[model samples]
Target: MPIPATAPARNTKSDTDPDALSVLNHVFGLPGFRGAQEEIVRHVTGGGNCLVLMPTGGGKSLCYQLPSLLRKGCGIVVSPLIALMRDQVAGLLEAGVKAAVLNSTLSYEEASAVEARLLAGDLDLLYVAPERLLTPRCLNLLGRADVALFAIDEAHCVSQWGHDFRPEYIGLSVIAERFPDVPRIALTAPADDLTRKEIVDRLGLNNAPSFVASFDRPNIRYEIVDKQNAQSQLKAFIAERHAGDAGIVYCLSRAKVEDTAAALNKSGVEALPYHAGLDAGTRARNQDRFINEDGIVIVATVAFGMGIDKPDVRFVAHLDLPKSIEAYYQETGRAGRDGKPSSAWMAYGLSDIVQQRRMIDESTGAEAFKRVSIGKLDALVSLAETANCRRSRLLGYFGETPAAAKCGNCDNCLSPPLVRDGKVAAQKLLSCAYRTGQRFGAMHLIDILVGRLTERVTQFRHDKLSVFGIGADLNEKQWRGVIRQLVAMGHLAPDSEAFGALKLTETARGVLKGETEVMLREQVAGARIRSVRTKSRRGDIAPQIAGSGGAANPGLVGALRAWRSGVARTRGVPAYVVLHDATIDGIATSRPTTLAGLRNIPGIGDKKLEHYGDELIALVKAAG
Candidate 1:
């Protein structure tokens, strides 16, 4: 290969200029930019530094990728995972962009060749992990190369206690001191206020402009149900609505991940297990199968995050509650990446609360860190117990003011849970906890409340207390709800030393004294399955959208998808890497019959058109 000369150092032209627009149209195959993308691209291409907090699948890549192509030399992207780098490079290659990854996956000679190409200015983009990017050899190579920009993707990893915390990411701040002239952009999805500040201070991006997009992902429907036979519930959920669809099941522990995967497989669902405990080879193979094949569900711990490049995940079901609202948001946001309707369902229960709180209480971290963790857990609990729209409160947690009080996409807004005054119920529960020496869990406490003389209750001789049988007005299930709500409200907490025993917080005193009023969602019998209908933004009832991009014709969607799958198999890449679901939906709806017709659709750039245009057109014509 010949050495390519570098162009000008900076292009101050607007992103909508003819050259930028042409590149967007002919190279990337998108007619226009999404929110804040064009402005961020223009600013970075003009040699400015910035920070971006856009939701997942909100086109965060284009903010830096476009500037990389339009400016002087190759753009260096700081990716957090090797899988993400590989997926990104694969997608870029299919779009006719020269991209490469330098990670553990590459041999010594391959990495050296990539370095040589970078120095020769023969590449448009380079994705490197933070550990490798911070190395002396890699830093020196970057110094010798004609670099156009530096993009810190998943920038929130710099936070000390973030869900995706990586110690190596802190070293990335050195980039600002070493490469001062190169315009840098740091991007993350749905970061909280604390994480935002940490990214600025730790990455040395305080001086950069911050572009915060709406945290709302309108394509996803959020639902939280009380946990009841969790494995069976998950099975029924998949069977009723998401049958044969690709979804993720999250477990809080590695053992649970393995168990869930095994259970799902036994239940006739194709599933795989992913966690840190697995060998690297097995993990890699499982991840590859999940990505390259269709209709495969991966039950995983947090280990399978940020690296998922699949765009057609129909749902993300949590078998347990997440530790914090931020963690929950990031995990659930992985669904509906292609702008089609999807589901974020979670099974939350009293044990989840106890387990999460116990973990925080038992952790050996400093008191300050534990305090922050507790606060985060409290916020997530509030979200789970809220009677209002889940989206409204979820967005509010990240400091985004939603446009409406009700999102109409979540379970609460759809059914509108009945809120009843639970002040008396809360007082009774708190009083019972106090009278019983606060040495029992919710289950044992419930037995006493509903006047049940179980073996343990008889052993404890607790049936003689005044508070016993005081809660008979409410059934056992409703009393359980009241106790759960009390714990959620901080009037009650689980004892770390007593193994699921309940304890009273200082706030419990006020509730017992009738100084505070409590409102809680009334417990009601839930059906085995619910309708999938949802209200769109205009308040019109819209049928459930399936497959990618909500194509009107199910038959055409299936035919187009089969053709795309064959191509993906031939290329040895994920189907989305060949063409995103959005692109498939676009082609299916338009039914393009010619090269020119296909080129007019979004996500079909010049290289994609040249590679698969004729076959796609023929398929569409045949389906017609």
Candidate 2:
């Protein structure tokens, strides 16, 4: 049951071509296409335009990268972020492809050199920002070059409804009109139906074939926890599960980013803060440190991690709610890029919704755009509060039906709670919001629910309200759930600019007047249990290592990992780069007992194979 040699390569041939598989093998180093990649590549390479909606790690790049290599002319890649374009170029170069990027970060001489290459047709792929591509001089150069294809990376940015919309991207349809014969492919990791339609309409992909890949990252475990002792919970979660893995901790604000990074560092995590507020050099340095060092934690605002190419991030923990599920999915998709198990942990409360909505309200977009943004935020709130499988809820949002009723990797699937009849509770909560003049946040509402005669309750002289102190049986946590679920159910709207004051929407009138029944569940704590189990399962994968002198065998690698783990525990260095998995796998497969044989391993250069040659050989012999 072994996979075919060409299984990973994309096939971009017409029905008449018989050597399609052969072409795939020669160019991409793999056998066949993955998912919709083959069809996408074939469509684009065969002079057909396409709109490809694939998940973050769903081989979207290969759909265009392979075609770029096979076609007769250079591919024009329009990307929003310069850093992301540079990373893609670097990856292509490492794979022995001719690629160049033109961005503002480059000096005049450097930019001119890339342009020279483009004009000479020396590059197979050229990455350019949309703003630069639309320039008169750049367009003139592109016209002269033998352009085979045009690709819009992060195509969702073109849509005003998308989480990361950019006005510049909407102008890219000009490329299509200018280069009518060259095939154009629009690619994005996360986009919904509205955004997808907007992308097609704005980018003029009217007659293009569209491919929508299933937006499910099964390898990522999702969990949402209540925001109580959030810092301690996050620390414990990181320490226990991701002890030696690269991860991101996303905060809502720059100050929170700095504070969280400091807290993680104080607790022995090698962490850094990144935000637009930081100087360019400091931000770049911190990003580099996170990428190069394993187990390094980066606490940053949403400004960070747009085009990061790190492949082994183990987790993404959000300290605040993202503006939309599309943003959340793209952010969490950064983890487990190497097809390993990873976690997406989030801690959110009513305050996050208020803050995010306030920002949205303050934006300069049209009213229709604001409405769409708010709707997306409400959908995300539903996902967070769902008592059903989190994975199913998330996938369902992107138009995929889940086969299983419960995904064993999510918080609700692992630890489900009993749903009590909260019809009366909902009515009470809604009535409290209405009777209290809809001007308070969750804390004040909780005080009224639990009959806490605090100063605020007495100062407002609102203890005399009929609904006040009526539901003292429910605890503060349960009351908060009622309020959150109300917000998620659209019965209550937390006014953004009024400092998160709770307001009873028109929908609340039904519940208040006993015309509608609201169902609610008490929020459950300790949803991290399933994620912990997944981490333990991943840890059970044995490491493969062998001796240096060809005197030992495959099992020796696992022993070396054990030894390395002990050493790393003492020295606090990650075990992966101390001895890469590839190095260990080679040693185990070859049983390289000699220093020369060890040097023959792919990742073990002479310096490393020589320095640790004796020690590894001895360990292998001891194991035997």
Best by lDDT: 1
**Per-residue alpha-carbon lDDT of model 1 for 1-624, expressed as tens digits?**
111222122354655355666677777888877788888888888889999999887889989998888888899999989889988898888887889998988999999999999998889899999999999999999999999899999998999767778899999999999999998999998777788899999877888899999888888888998887899989988888788888899999999998899999999999999999999999999999889888999999987967577888889999999988888988998887887778899998889999998898889989998998999999999999998889999999988899989887788876677799888888888888888888888988888888999998889899998888888888877877788888898889889999989999998888778888899996355633243434455353322322224454567778888887898898888889988877777777777778988888888887788788888888888887
Q: How far is 432's C-alpha from truth in model 2 (Å)?
A: 2.5
- Please write out the lDDT profile of model 2 over residues 1-624, one tens digit for every residue: 011343333233444133344444433333356788777777777878989988877778888887776677788899888667866775455334688888788899999998888778788888999999989988898888888789998899898788887888878879878888888899998688899999999877888778988887877888888777778889988988888778999998899899899999999999999999999999988986786566788999988887676667889999999999999999999987655678899988777777878888899989988998898999999999888889999999988898877877776776786677777998888788878988888888888878889999999977888877988988987787788788889898878657779898898888878888777865555443744434432242222333334433456767876765665455443444356554555566676557766555654533344346788777756755
RMSD of 2: 6.3
Clash pairs, model 1 backbone? none
Root-mean-square deviation of every model: 3.1, 6.3
Q: What is the C-alpha lDDT of each candidate?
A: 0.84, 0.77
